[model samples]
Target: MTPGALLDLTDATPDPARMRHERHARLVASMREDGVDALLLLGQANAGYATGVRVPACEQARALHRRPVALVTADGADPHLWTWYPDGAPAGLRADHVHPGLRLEFDADARALVSAVHDVCPTGAVAVDEWTMPLRAAFDHPVGDAGPTIGRAKLQKTADELACMRRAQRINEAAVADVKAMLAPGVRGTDLTARLLERAFALGATGNTVDPIWQVMPSSIASGPHTLTGDVIFPLCTTTEPFARGDVIWVDNGLQFAGYQSDFGHTWIVGGAPDATKRAQCARYRAVVDAVVDAMRPGVTARDLTRVARAVEDGRRTPWLAHFYLGHGAGTESAEAPLVGTDLGDAFDETVVLLPGMVLVLEPVIWDDGHSGFRAEDVVAVTETGAERLSSLDFSDYESTR
Candidate 1:
């Protein structure tokens, strides 16, 4: 066993096991409403959210992260966590205290899974994350459509869930600071990213849902978003071409602390005077983001907010340059419902309204060949009056790194 290093930050204790039971009850209630007898969660994030178990199967040792599935057959009955490896541990020591009703059991085939469900649910509607079940395994029984129900539940985060997300944001801010300090000319991209990863663990991050992605594009490389290797790297832009005076460096990364993920992007210039166009561009993006953040309140529609952001962006010289919405909600997933975009339909229902406990990501960016990309992402909580920013880091100045 590789001895784990002691961390300065206290390990996040798992929520009361009862929380899982409560969530299970809620899931089962929803499942029953849909006439489903059992709900099978195959996705790791969903499984972990449902049972607090966070281990991957041996087959998932590659780039893919594996999460064991948990089958909840009844509204209040014990749920079975099926996995080849049952005793694996999670960051919050969730495995140590399984709910009195939730337990892990080994399964070699679909027959065992069917047998287990039959023992409890007997006969009724069955549901599963269709994407996860194999064709052969799915043939064992008929399942109902659970996509909408599960997605809606996942999209609307509870107060306790928002608290966990804030913890993630805190860790993410520190990791970003560490990445910035590691930036310098001549530093290898891999080395820079490695340091950021070290800092993440050192600062008490319980490994991220995804690896910290940092890609340092050399100025020699065209200044384009695609230049990123689709992952985080250090010295954000190549130090080989070391950020020169007046050169713009783009940084895009998602800081995952705890189980939540925060996506943010900003562009910085090595040494340059404020150019009128650059200053205006930065201000435009910031204003749109600010408006969206301020616009969040109970009873407001996500689409309306996106429209507001787009209108603000369109006022600028490059109207359509800023295409997407100002931001989205971040919890177990990076991009979930209540999105500030028009493309999303009832998934971001305005009637749902903002609850005081709801947490969301406020990020808006503008990118054009003539100008660079600039955006700020922060976690915020909805209050009675409006929305309150949760991130403590300074994001006021986005044009320069100093």
Candidate 2:
């Protein structure tokens, strides 16, 4: 498998200080465009994006309860980080904006956070990525949803972000491939899940790094009847149920690296090659995916992709196959803005136009009731000319010799 063209590691790894400054600048520009005077960031992804400090996953639970917030103004000034414990702040944090030693409850902390925002920008409307009752009562000015603006800011990938995502995707594909090789009639679903995690870690996957860290998401492994029907139910095969011959094993998983993610799925038929019916179904699914991939390019809107996907399904005489989303933007979170297809309705801001530096995952699925299902997902990075597939694993063959 050939790796896609990527920036060299030396070039891709930006100095942490400089990276944070760049991110802050971009976010401030977005705020100005959106008419936001200041931002109160609550989401972990947004906080990390604004500060370049990796917020530990363990802290997220506390954040949800206590609300760890970051305040940034529209002038690109250094953001102020507010949390319950400033003494335990992440490394290299500037003490100027770090507000530690605060109460965990909403009223006190919300007052402190609002006061901090006022310290920076006293008179304009304050937007927040997430809001609570306490925040609404404490702030005097208007509070708007900052999720869309922050999400759009994250849509375009920096060179470092793209490189890290590419590496994570390669490692993820390798680990999934290892688990697929163990797909035998007697292998338990839990066993495969365990092996996937083991392989991912054994290959240097991590959740801590300023450059290219990674963390594996919980895997969805299903086989036999589970793979034969609607919605591809997850955790069904995560039981001790053993695989049976002719059972279709479907695995959907992802790995997060340097705050970016690699999300996709692949299906393997146990024991031998699929029969004619299964082969035909797989072919049709492949055709649909290929069509979408071929159409991915700069200036194409999500709505346009939706239309293309619908036309393909219609032409195939299997319109029912268009059940789920065609694809979505892949980044810090596995699923982000500019969601492709799946009836977005009239949300103009949500239907994003494809741009260079946007990474997307094209996933299409085909299923037959009481029979089997097929799905193959690939990651592609949009470029000045077109898109380049970052995932190099060979998904062409679904048959396993186990």
Candidate 3:
């Protein structure tokens, strides 16, 4: 496998077994480095990443009681999982290593978890992604945060992981094409969502990560929803509100496959044509993304990217939402580490250094104020040489307007 390869979409499929094994190896290495004896991942994506386990998509409240729990030790054995879906576990793990689901929020289940954990590792620093009150009170071990260990391990993508992302994005884009074709003055936000989700499922999407966002942006911030930060409230919850001609709709969403999530974002003008003013805004948005990407490579900091993005923005409203970020890493989860141009300030961005294998979703926005705006997302993988585009969707709407 090529290390630090530029991520691209291909017809080649990855072996799920190999991907799980490699990913586990990386987690083990990070665990060893961090002196973590065991990892108890309660988060859905974290558990799925630790083991090749899949659960049907559900709301957070339902998932809490029913979530799969993964236990990995520094001993480098297959994951020991307490999962509701035993069939979802990989074949590499023995049946004994897979146990019935644990109701971790209750004291009874926490006791069982404590016993099971002690039975295996008995001693070492334990890392946990989440904790309940009962869990903390019952299993009194040296519990540390799993963020650092998980972060380091997930920071770099294995070749197989990149391949999964490419396939997922391909499905997302193809499905989105259908939505774009059907966009019109009479279409509601839900109409776009229904079309995209249906097409995605047909295209082999395993699940939907986020409720599809088809926000019809207002002509001005004052005309839109009230925001304490005064930043444009993008991705406002979808409603039955129908689209009107010239309405600028910004879409952002995630589709899942093999536990990896694909992020798709782009702005569309209702009725398929944009005025010259809106078209100019789209061009400016592209320039900012280009400048940031041109400056992207191994060793660059998020500060460097933000600086370039802002420079190209030429003193606009930050080229991104003040509440959100210019870009973020993508993996098993929709958004993860190394965030850029966030409210976290320059000091934080300085700490986020670009490295090979890191996948980024850069979303630069261009607002014309009284007349709506333009925005879209582009996925790129930082390689040994430079940033490679993982997303292939082009600025078709912008081009048509031009």
Best by lDDT: 3
What is candidate 3's lDDT per residue for 220-261, written digit by digit as tens? 999998999997887788899889987888999999878888
Q: For candidate 1, what is the TM-score?
A: 0.76
| Predictions in order: lDDT | 0.56, 0.67, 0.86
Arrange candidates, best lDDT first. Answer: 3, 2, 1
**Model 3 local distance difference test score:** 0.86
TM-score against native, each model:
0.76, 0.81, 0.96
What is the Å distance of residue 157 in model 1 from its true position?
A: 2.4
Steric clash pairs (candidate 3): none
Clashing residue pairs found in predicted model 1: 37-125, 213-231, 213-232, 214-231, 214-232, 214-233, 215-233, 216-236
lDDT of 1 by residue, 1-402 (tens): 011323223322336455455556667667766777777776666666666564532344431223466676656566666543455433333353232222222334455556666766777777777443342363465666667656656655555565556556556666666666655544444564577668766766655554433343333325334533431222333333344455555555555544556555555544444366566667776787677777877667766676677677775433222234456676666766555553344366455466555667766555544455444565676776788776654544445543
Model 1 worst lDDT window (10 residues): 1-10
Clash count for each candidate, listed in order shown: 8, 2, 0
- The per-residue C-alpha lDDT of model 3 at residue 206 equals 87
lDDT of 2 by residue, 85-125 (tens): 44335556677777663443468877877887887888886
N/CA/C clash count, model 3: 0
TM-score-based ranking: 3, 2, 1
